[model samples]
Target: EKAEALGVPAGPERSRLVRGESVTLADGRIVHPDDVLGEPVPGAKLVYVGDASRVDDLVEEARGADVLVVEATYLEAEADLARKYGHLTAAQAATLAREAQVRQLYLTHISRRYSEREVLAEAEPIFPHTVVAKDFDRVRVVKQQ
Candidate 1:
């Protein structure tokens, strides 16, 4: 009801669309998919990616999104674990963001075992503008400059 009041569709149009997922990294850090996406809040539309296999669903739903919040939970060395846990690494998330043509990409749901510097280092090579989310940080997404 609140989401509707703020113009977010009460439900996704596609039944196959994902709302979120959970996973454990090779380093033993646990992450829930929604944790990466911040909160649903009142205004934003959400299309969760429950697992990596659902990349197609993510791509389709993310089309034209002004802001795309994704996860880079692996370091490629742990890609096997990434697949096992259903999360994407920095490269994968950036690829999806590019393919979907989203205006901005915010990477989230990181393994807490890593420092903020490490996370940024892992994500920057792929997504130039990627920002690792910090608690209480505010990101304003307006349509245009």
Candidate 2:
């Protein structure tokens, strides 16, 4: 669980460095901070939003993400219920994807009341890249050149 155990130097300033950027340590050792960061591949912004009822608050964080994984726990017909339970509807999830301009969107945490088809139907029209996530489904988000 230590960053150094994973070959990444642990420190407060590590996150602020970008790819190919380097910093010199007090002990005279040089470190390329980005080399130890997550997402070894370049040109992709990956985001995951869970248990979020409101997407409006996440607009800035989700902007221009290559892939966004979010929750759609209710159908549009159950908007009131979704709000009460602090969960997003399929439509709302799609709206968030559209607003964020994410290249791909995967919807998860669906309520048992709706089928996978129903969730996809509600989201696809709003955001063409939307998909319903099933158990153990693996999705790859490749950055477009």
Candidate 3:
């Protein structure tokens, strides 16, 4: 806007152009000129959450993530135990992924008391993209239009 303020105006004069000092995102996030842009083409975004019970800002933090790796330590039926242990239920993790709009949801840090099939069954109805993490399993996240 400096050009407009100073009446530098626009035309064939390349030098008259003024590059804004900052770029503003729709969410009101500001990007400085010196900021480092992450990822390359198709820009993948991954959010990793450990054994958290309830993270207040998790939804905002994981918004638009291509992949969200979070803990699902128990089934919804054992929500009380999950809360007692500061862990999340399978359904809770799925809800978080859905709210965050992540493309893929990987459930991890499961408790020994529960089976992977049970956890998967609890989450799949809420978020169809949910995956019950297996040891040494690998997944590639790619941005989609």
| Most TM-score-accurate candidate | 2
Clashes counted in candidate 3 amount to 0
Q: What C-alpha RMSD separates each model from the true structure?
A: 17.1, 7.3, 9.9
Q: What lDDT tens digits, residue by residue, belong to model 1 across residues 40-75? A: 455544434534623656787887677878877766
Instruction: Please give the lDDT score for candidate 3.
Output: 0.78
Q: Each model's TM-score?
A: 0.58, 0.71, 0.69
Range of the 10 consecutive residues with the lowest summed lDDT in candidate 3: 11-20
TM-score of 3: 0.69
* Model 1 lDDT, residue 113, Cα: 68
Superposed Cα RMSD, model 3: 9.9
Score candidate 2 by lDDT. 0.82
Ten contiguous residues minimizing lDDT sum, candidate 2: 1-10
- Looking at model 1, the pairs that clash are none
Using lDDT as the measure, the top candidate is 2
lDDT of each: 0.63, 0.82, 0.78
Q: What is the descending TM-score order?
A: 2, 3, 1
Report the lDDT tens digits of candidate 3 across residue range 1-145.
4433333324422231223355444456544433432234557899999989885669999999999999988888888988899999889899999998889999999988887788888999999998888999989888767
